[model samples]
Target: MTFDRQDLSNETLLHLYQHLLRPRLIEEKMLILLRQGKVSKWFSGIGQEAISVGSTLALEADEYILPLHRNLGVFTGREVPLGRLFAQWQGKRTGFTKGRDRSFHFGTNEHHIVGMISHLGPQLAVAGGIALADLLDKKPKVTLTYSGDGGASEGDFHEALNVAAVWQLPVIFMIENNGYGLSTPSNEQFRFKSFVDKGPAYGMEAVQVDGNNVLEVYTTVKRLAEDLRENPRPVLVEALTFRMRGHEEASGTKYVPQSLMEEWAAKDPVENYEKWLLAEGILTETARHSIRETIKAAIEAGLQEADAVPMPTADIQEEIADMYQPFEAPVTDAPAGSAAPDKRFIDAISEGLKQSMERYPDLVLMGQDIADYGGVFKITEGFVAAFGKSRVRNTPLCESAIVGIGLGLSIKKKKSMVEMQFADFVTCGFNQIVNNLAKSHYRWGQNADVVIRMPTGAGSAAGPFHSQSNEAWFTHVPGLKVVYPSNPHDAKGLLCAAFEDPNPVLYFEHKMLYRSMSGPVPAAYYTTPIGQAALAAEGDELSIITYGMGVRWALEVCQDLGVSADVLDLRTLLPWDQEAVRRTVEKNGRVLILHEDTMTGGIGGEIAAWIGENCFEHLDAPVRRVASLDTAIPFAPPLEAAFLPQQRLREQVQALRNY
Candidate 1:
């Protein structure tokens, strides 16, 4: 409670108290709307309002705030209109999310707030990335991230905090320890004496505050915020509070002990703070009463306005379609077909990344062991010295957090590229990639312009852990674009194309083809069109549609058989060359879609289905597909090769050609 007395004017004190009560009043209004059948569901932070309000008050206007579903106070304090909050719940287009989401899930870049999704742990790393970006840009700012006790248990939580601590990021990790995580009590949730103690383990300053005491929480955060701005380092704050209500209104407090609830109720944050303010002569009773009355009036009017706001008509489609709008490239193709020397696939990709970074100073490359050691594959060799450690960062082995931080950096107008050590490990950060990074733009009109370089496909006997082709996982997500290039030229071109695109993209560079494949690649800056397929070979008998390693295999098979078959290399998988396939099938009348991933749910299946639907009449035969066996990638060379279906692809193609 050491904040300057001069700074603690009557207006400031009154505002603090009002902030503590605002969320509760809003919750009550939302409940009334729900009862009136105006809205659907809500997740209110009844007892956690004090920490939400106080923590937010410590932040400056320029800093970022990443709040979970319960941090309504943080949103309202950041000047998010309560009417918009109601509109989101009511699915009205006037809401911040434009009726795309229901719940406290919208954010505005102008407000310096990125609202949390259902999985709250990822936001911690995202906030840390923002803080890291601010430090790099020499901006005097800090990011504050919030999570509940339950969210703290997630691996993302640990990874994010560890990165923040290691980098000494100007980020504050605040855990609202609400005694219980849903129905699970603290005693059953963890073995630690207190959540604050965990911070020191990660080299962060740890403090446990009386979360119910608004003044204590505010002062603690203010001091930490000031120190962070001066000497940037992450801090951990555990605000010990109680749920007061169940996880949601429908759940009720049946699980919470009545005795415990009553005991905590006696220490109501608002009532106690109001009493202290009145006694200290900081807040007059009349003024305090007026503040409450004004807030109540606002809540009533805001709810009404939200209810009347109509659902968006055609706006969402317009926005989704706008994603396809092309950005004017800073540099175009080499003057009219200037020939460049051939480069290795690995070298081509590295060169392409280097060229893109040079063109856009804000372009960043981040991953594990990517600095001094270069990378597991050396794809970013000498990148640290060339781009500086700030741009070519060596992140900890926190997969999800790395992607999450990349997301944060991406939204701040910095072009970020994340190197997933291997495609298999991307699963660690699946929640962030699929939920936040992918959908952030569609949900809140914020650009998560991130390119994740996934060194994928198996042939090195590197085992299941290191080798995987998980492009289909991303292709399935609505907001993500998937790219899997087969050769040196396409690897360089498609990767650069991903950087230019203003949405999240998964760039799968086949490890099997990295050193093995070599072809002509332009030295000049250029982007191969994203949705187009490359016609590697042409003929009249059959069509072989494939991507990545499969394209090379298809070429070898068609040539060895001496069959007059057309070969199409689908360089970009998600926005796969649908038109190219249609044309090829129409001409050849027989087609085979192939890939390296497992058969049951591979991208080949999607292509096969599309062909079945779109070009059924043109088929001289059934559209065939070839993929790896439906199981974990075996470790043995013989087993792995057999599992992958590489050797047998030629036979399958031969049989189809003969038929």
Candidate 2:
């Protein structure tokens, strides 16, 4: 049977066929290494080689792609060197990720490819964000994103599809329906006749094609991609294929039927295409043989070179985030002095976003109810009118996908500031933030200049879902900056700093302080230096270490008791002010760590340990902690106040004074 390629020349078809062999041969060598224990494990897209290479051949060299765990052809077709590929696979220090990541997880800015996570669906939304950027900039580009049938069932898939369609993003959402998720078949995952059918429901042009037929995938993608670059419409192509291998090397895959495996083997994409190539006189037997032999030898040489490189030694520095890097942009005068205009903390944050967007043209604001409604807290009030809708977008309630889309946009050199409606609800998108956004910096030295705005802390009976001070969650993570600013000055300053720094930042804004607190806030651009603490009140007795609303409480209690104390407000959490803590503790001879989070397993423990080691000799009393009781935040106002740390604050201060 003859196949149609629209207008692809024989030479292009022959070249595409050779591209197919590259990944196949390299992965074949990888399997050998896995068996020999030279490499860790493998996630092979072995059986579906044609779709992998053909779709890649269809796109322009400069166009962007966000690939999944499979699709090794993406790297090979993009001209990522075989040695770097093997070294990364072998977990060598010479690898593209510098031995920081495993599997097919690395990216190069030169190629404009963003490596994917094992939880594959987030990349779909990320690609949408990138497409949004290209659309805003009026660049002639189309983003190609990959997903699996099982991944299509994920919430991120629908979220990504909806956002892409609503915004009219220039992205092609390609799903490789490989018949299985892991061990379970697609029948168990979804009941739809075809995953492609759901795409139109998301307002996208959808199509299904035989993925094994290289010409079919190439022609379909090529036609859609050409239109996408100019028109900026999102399309969904479901490539019908099957996974001949298990999910990974260790996964036995005994669940697959022998007859089904045999059937797919008969229709193997590589073998089927080779016959078509020879029948059409597109490639000679000698040429095809030479292609395999060339790649095989190259893969072998790369493996040998990787073997010669020493295993990377462990470095503690990699685990610590680069939080305090000096800003690349020129610094305006610091927004200090008591003569500055008085403003509420919430207003300061809004002004900061406004000034930041004005200073940095690429700065974008996105979140739920943030555009017209001014967000749930009104922190982004009037932003849509001032910056226009494109800069200030209202996203669907897909929290994880929101973060995922922001990450994708950041990969393309756009700065994104996303709002987590309530800090407690950020858990919905935790995987994308921690795994994808946080790791990108250390893995390949790629900075995700994304800032996640979290309205945190419990007050005003917002209860369990709306109120939570989960700052410790991010402080424990590597390659992430945790900023919890208390007063209006620091809130505006640190937020500007978060925007300037080239890293992922979790800026936690306390909900309680939004309306209740007021202080001098400068209108001009400035940064509250990260990795440092501010002295709220200077005194020679009793070191008070606190952050967020705890700062307010500490100052109030100290003034109430008429005690002379050194109150230190930790502006940033991850890189806490250790120097300030040591000096203040040594000078005062007593200490108290205060926070609104629960007592057990809080960040206070880390601080206590630090004081124990560094300034043990200078302490007059044991370093004490005053935090909320160990209980879920209650809904009732009285219960909530009782559960929080008001009683602890008064008792801890008096105890330190008596000591």
Candidate 3:
């Protein structure tokens, strides 16, 4: 069946034709450059240009689009500056990612586009985040995201769809069924007749369209988006098409049957669209030649500009810069009065979150059972009532999708704090935390202004799944900030500080300390500077460096042994107080680093190595470390106690003092 072009104006027809033809020409040229070794790799959308161009043009300028690697038409359709796009493909410094990322892996906020990662399904959840932000603000904005048939099989796909459906978010999940996922045919991917059949399980509307007909794709998306603005909800669109080229230039199409390729070739969107445009008298031979020549000239100019751009250098100073946005703590005066009441560690954290919500109107809290249920620990018990359900939200058990949603909120200039009921479960969302949140600022200047509250540490007899000191895991990652506080005062202050910081901060709270630990907490809000260690006690003979529950053990051991020692609380582990460490090592001439994580890969080893490398001359004795045994926490009380560093810490400190 032919597309009806009678309603569309002549100018709109020409513009749509140009958008469809531009990506085709560019891809053809890039393939040539790839063969000549000028380009590293290329993913050609040769036969499926209509899906990208039509869907992109259907949205308003203010709306966001998350495009996949092969969606060159989306970039060109959005007018993303051909020169910069070409520069990005060439790995030149002038690109949107400053050459940090290759191809379309980087997003450009100026054009309202969030680029795709190699893990294609995660972006769907991120799109949900952006949609959620718009819903909260009551904006009539919609987000459109793309995925291939193969990507639909990923767990994140189902998670994202389920969350969007439950929340009634305004997002369009566009799946381009290109018949082949790399070399495997679509028959091998799933048993469903079509992607639309799976949408009913998600409780969302779904539709199928002729991907080769640009008009159908455009009209379908345009109509759906208009409806979504008035009534926010998720919808799935399956665009049936074919991949005319290999997944990448390196991977040939030898696996594709020639008969199937020929069948799809007859349905080429670009060629078919041009023929219809000509037959309808919207374009003459002269105009078509003129259009082709103009596009050719533009492609040459962009390539020339990109070729002139220089490559990035291996300068260490430049490489380290822009990893994180500079954050300055607001100066808050200490609350006065000896009458201030003592509070539990959990109460202090709750107070900080409450204060932050009051401070930042756009702050959002999300976690499993956080809203009505008040979370597993009751930290957000009254938050839903105070802040309302919009700000204090309950999330599904899908950690990866929730984390990606937090990132999406951050992308839209909203602040979010996600609570993990237990620290050990973070493994489920490790990719989003380490790869997306940690690298966003360094790779593309996008600050993931997120705070992840981790209920960490042992002694609760919660077994291996619920109890684990996992701060060391995040400290090893470059783009994250790790903070652990020992008492109520620091807990409140540091939690407030983490909320204010622009980078992603992992705030670790000891489960045992929630009720077992209590101290004086001021009523007013304040921020304890991250990366600053507090001097818990002062003595010149020996220094005990630790944080969290370890600080309590160190102080108790020092008092019990009658040893005059300097006890230091290293609040933030990522940017640990190196200067303070140096001063203590130089004065005491001995050091003992204590932690609750396993001894082998704990932060203690890193601190000891740094001291030995930088302060070896001043040391009277070798630096020592005391940590938990390299085994999982057991359910029994005795086994759990033995697995911790309580007794071991005492012996290590005494041994260091004697030495």
Candidate 4:
């Protein structure tokens, strides 16, 4: 397709040509390096440079772009330092992720780039979130996120588009139809004629452009982005591009037909754009050679600098330090006198969320039925009226997308709290929570300051789907804080602490205890240190380490049996108080670890192992654990009672104390 320049300046046209050429040259050099075994792997954007370059150049400098692995032009167009980009690809300490992530998997806030996770569609939802922040902040900013034709089939694609359309978020969902998702052709990916056809289902406007035409892609995105900034709505732009090379350097193009390759090769973005530039008298052979030489020189310099940098060392302390952003709880004096009104566990959580929303203007609450219906547990009751619909959002039943949006908000330095409704349903959003949110901070130094409120535990007779004590799931993942509070005071304080934290926190609230548990909760805002365990009851005979509903069970069992036990409420499972646990284990020679989760993979096993390893000499008896049976939570009250450690816990404590 021949193109009008859209009155683009000569300098602007030249700039576009340089960007298109830069990535092509970089890919060539990287391919040589890959052949020489210098770089491990490379996902070449050799023929599809126009889509990334044009789309990136079209956005405002501050506008965020979530690029895919093949969008090398996006980085070059953004002018990210070649030295750092090469260092990242070379696995050097000077890279953006400090050698933790490979290729374009890392993001830099300085460049307004949110990196892509290998999971393709989640980033689209995150883009919705970034756009949401801009909308809330009243900034004329737009977010452009890329997806392949293969990614278009993901459930996240539909969820993200629907959410963006419904909320009128200023986002551009760019589908780069590159014909294959790792050898699977677009024909097998989706039945729809084009991604643009799917837009109407979400009430979104979509357009298709010649992805290989630099001017066409640039003009199309520029118009859409300008419109979005003023109008603040989502638009779908499908760029018809083809992957010229294999998925990566190691993957040969044997799967791709030679005829198909020839067709796309004729329309190579770099070659076509260069031809157009020369034909338009916008560039000459001399200028083209000079630009190539300059880019080549820059690439060599970057490679030299990256080669000189050392690889990440095996320092365990440094590795641990980089896992999470250090957070210090702000100190606040306890309220004088014990005259505070007693509040239910649910009410305590409500108050904490309300207070946090008031304190952090950028704080947003998202969940199903949260705004008008106050959430399933009514934790956000009357929140919409008090904080407005903008802050208290009612999300669709898209757990994965909602969780991803929360991460996006955090990327923009905004705080977000997502309510899972039921902890068991977290599996739907597990990838976003575990992969994106959990690894974000450690991988890219991007603090995912998100709190996912998990209404957990059994005894409500809500069956397996609604009732689960799944804190152990997040506790096992690094870069996440797992907090399971037992009582009203701890719930409120811990929720506040999680809100103030700089990392992703899974705050598990026991559903059974929501109404059944109550305690004097201070009206004043305060934070409970996350990693500190509370000595709920002090005794010398035995140490009972527990959390959530297990705390109450242990306390009640000890009180009923008149057993002098040290009841330690490990509110934070991820960074549970090791020192406090050791002290209690030493003071009381017997140890019993308890939790509401099933026995086999429950967190109790980890606690028991830690005790055996660290407090073995202090133990008077073998470390014992009391947990639910290793079976799905039963519906019948009798079976559930048996499944939980209610009667068995009492028996285990008595048995351990005697031993």
Candidate 5:
């Protein structure tokens, strides 16, 4: 928070001024393009340039950065060409993303500037993960992420912060308090007056500074970046800056009172810094005018070149398309009907992890409590001894960092198998999952080959925060492969298959079924085909389509009621077993879809609707759906029992009788 003006060489000062000036000109030109409807949209960082530029220049070449939309300063400082930036805005082929990505969706593997995500909190974890990679590689580098005050209120922000602090991650969290998120000011969204105060609560040192002053931003960030290599811990820099423009182009300044704009404009960071430079004889009015004109001309030429460029052809677009060779059916000793005695679901997972790691030396297992603690449910016991700590390593309690590091390693051609303590906790790394891992392949034509194991589903009475089936949140994304395993065979087989798949796969394991279910699994290294379903049981009455814990519960209810039920386990949700569901419904007289997720917008509903529209003629009854209520998972045992699917098989029997 302390600021003492240190003398800088003229060359360094000029370089700083030039970096800030270029992005400002580009912003102004983008606004003009915005008004003309030439560019899609523009996010202007007029007053926040100093922070972005200053922080960026403080780091070395190999350090990682995840910038928010208003980080043109970072891009400029990194020497990302103005022509490339304009091409992206114009949706031209010359754009870094080859016209597939939008203007703000730019990234470079060589530059180490990871793409910016539209979501708020994911970058916190991703940056932490990058730092984790550096620590593992024995490299001297830090990861920095930028977010606005509004984004700080998200669950991911707090979750990532807590994890980073607990693990003492080498990360610098930069909160650019730009006064407002759209129309809502920071005060309206948060109870605390300043975000820096929350850093200590997460066990980190925080500094507040005048973001408008270039020297102040540069010096503070430089000091923190250096401290990271020695006494490594997460740092929070809450930069008090103002937004000179609205949230985006077309979002006018009409929402703000004229007096307020005038007041802030009088202390504009660009002008304030310029005045300071001139007063100190570091810069002259002529020099400032020349800098502005030079940048303006450069932006003009860049825009002209971008407009003339062609759109990316489809061939160029798919060059980096994710491709994975699906696993062939394995020859096993257990025949169909060679059923084994029931066992705990966690036992299957432990076996699965063991089998996968043994099969593929590249498959590494990591997460909090997953090693010595054997996971929250004893799913990874004796893994460290079996595979050694290098492979089955226990990470610091930083979820975002864990996932983010997985991403960095995956991009470096290393296979990573990560575990989230619980499904609900995955929200901490949502940004990394959604923004970086999910879109990396499609965005830059390279796959982030990573596997994330989420122990999900309810009925454990672990309460709302601990137990929840939120897999559908990820199934909706295009590039992510989502798998929910219901039994021992599928848990091991699907995970093995996921390791082979090129895209990022979210393997959702049921916590309730961990100890209550068991089945025959192949002892050898084997993998099942990704996106394929299994017909667990065959019957004449109805087809029960389900996955995870629902598969086990449905089968149990069928046996107890002595009903002839056909059950289909949809092992993968994204590339769902649509064909299998249709063929099964065609053979069975009725169709029943069941899941443990919330009723509204759950995967079961989507499947049922697809069946109703596609196979309505084959059914003897309407597709029946049984799902949890549209509410957070409850803590009380009885209430949770009522919330999750418990009687779907009986319901199917009753429906058959009615039919």
Candidate 6:
């Protein structure tokens, strides 16, 4: 272990040189294709090849990794075919992920690489989750993650590190400190002496190394990998490297001065590794030339293969295109079971959670103040008493970690229910939700049976952050199922339905109505169908399409204003109530979509357009919408009154009256 270059064997030297050259040649070939307009675009990992290749070699076969956009070296090492990589760049059928994922954001089910995401910081939490699973299952595996120094600034990066450190998870966070993050230099991004130093604050081991020296990276990671395999815990390693090319294919060297480029060029990892191999008598001139020739041939062959692969068929595209597949709603004559008496919305959620927990023993619920505190809304009250701490547990005030752990548990095939203390604090775990849990099933096809309970919506003067309706954000994503329940019956039914669904569901329970709202629920244990809509009224004049609390508001307005408005409550957003909407528009001949969300690009507008396109002849009047103004939810009572659509405003019946 003494500091001596002589300690390295010729075989080790040759391997390092070969690894460095692999990515370099790939980068060169990618750029050539880019110039020829054969490949769409690429983010060159030309200079940072050693960092990816060496860091990846450090990982065990069964271990996990969350690579960034620039880590093609890792993909190559993982045995992802060069043809698939080329196909991805060319946006062809042969591409991994069927050309849906980015060129660098590749995944392989057989290889166990979960895939890359464009979002910067969320991978930290996802990696932590994988490591958490290893800890829980007593699996001898580590999750190695690579994020740039710029990505280090993301709240998720800090949050993930803190969670993993506290839990002593088997995660190795490798920061590829390439001096600059796109245009911003390290001096501007951070004040720390080194990114590695941040690890100690989170109660984890830290190390920094010459990222250019593939040997240094390999040695550091190899030791850490062994440690993780034995006694799994968190470790942070910062590799000082450089980006030889522009940030992306669209960018150019105009941003970087020639002098600075020339300075870093002198220490090229590919060239330096080659020199090191020659000095160690590992790789001679002939072998080096042969390796280069081999890589060149492989890349050319891959491109040719990629060019030949058939594009995905339009039929296949049409089949999976719609993420939100509305359930074929069953005929709703009263069930053969007796209806349960009225119960509080809160009570219904608690009952459903309890029943769900009892049914699925593996399902665990964790969040702050959830144990004795029973959650801020008391929805999870008495859960700890029944299931104990391991299953029904209280957590630290780290939202990221809470969701991260839930994700890990879900991937391990344990159903998980993670509640944000309040919908407001979900911003703390936004990265985990938006990037990891939401896309887990779509990206990896690893069924993430997780439900995120978010108490959201306005009217209780909880101010802008706490009372905001934020379902629009989750609805935009393809894989997630967003649900909002307006009453106890729907809440219980939808909550139960969420637990039964294979995809991750965002179960948003409006806190304002939780204790107040009560309705008739069936006594029997059953799961309400997801993606189905409940028709509140039969009307011919107009269709008031709504969901969540909007359903209640619309019903009230319809009764008060004497408007023949047919109201529908969509219990799910991803697989929305498309048929219900279609039937209502067909019957009513007029559509007036409504929601509490902002008017711009809200679900209401989407539904309106769908009806307009499909049921154009059914219209008696122009389709209208009543929604919150396109502004942030206000804090003051008066301003908030103006911002949110009042029931009085919706009561006008003008959209129908005008018809």
Model 2 alpha-carbon drift over 4 Å, by segment: 318-332, 335-339
Q: Against the true structure, what is every candidate's RMSD?
A: 2.1, 2.0, 1.3, 1.2, 5.0, 3.9
- Candidates sorted by lDDT, descending order? 3, 4, 2, 1, 5, 6
TM of each candidate vs. truth: 0.96, 0.96, 0.98, 0.98, 0.81, 0.86
Model 1 lDDT at residue 579: 92
lDDT of 4 by residue, 70-125 (tens): 99989988999999899999888899987888988989889999889988889999
lDDT of 4: 0.89
Candidate 3 lowest-lDDT run of ten: 332-341
Give the lowest summed-lDDT range of ten residues in model 1: 322-331
lDDT tens per residue, model 1, 1-659: 22233467777777898888888888877778777777677676877788889989978877889988788888888878877777777888888777777786767888888888887788898897788789889987889989888889989999999989888898888899987778888888888989878987998889999888877788889989998899999999999888777787788889887899998888777777877887888888898788889999999888778767777777666776644333554454655677788899999999899999998898888888988899988988888888898888888899999888888887677889889888899889899889988788778788788898888889899888988878888888877888888888888888888888888888988887888878988878788878789898999999989888888888888788788888899888777888998999999999988888889888888889999999999999988888899889889999998999777688788778877
lDDT of 6 at 57: 78
Tell me which of candidates 2 and 6 scores higher on TM-score. 2
> Model 5 compared with the native: what TM-score?
0.81
Model 5's C-alpha root-mean-square deviation from the true structure amounts to 5.0
Candidate 2 lDDT, 29-131, residue by residue in tens: 7888789998888998988877778788889998888887788988888888778778888788888777878887877777778888778887888888788
> Can you tell me which runs of candidate 4 are displaced by over 4 Å?
none
Count the clashes in each prediction: 0, 0, 0, 0, 10, 1
Question: In model 1, which regions exceed 4 Å deviation?
Answer: 1-7, 312-316, 319-331, 337-339
Q: What digit string (tens of lDDT, one per residue) describes model 5 on residues 596-627?
A: 88889998888888887888888787777888
Clashing pairs in 4: none
* C-alpha lDDT score of every prediction, in listed order: 0.84, 0.85, 0.91, 0.89, 0.78, 0.77
Model 4, TM vs. native: 0.98
**Could you tell which candidate, 1 or 4, scores higher by TM-score?**
4
lDDT of 2 at 93: 85
Question: Over the stretch 326-346, how does candidate 6's per-residue lDDT look in tens digits?
Answer: 334343333686778888888
Residue ranges of candidate 5 with Cα displaced over 4 Å: 1-8, 93-103, 178-201, 249-294, 310-344, 355-368, 384-450, 456-474, 539-543, 549-566, 586-590, 594-602, 616-648, 654-659
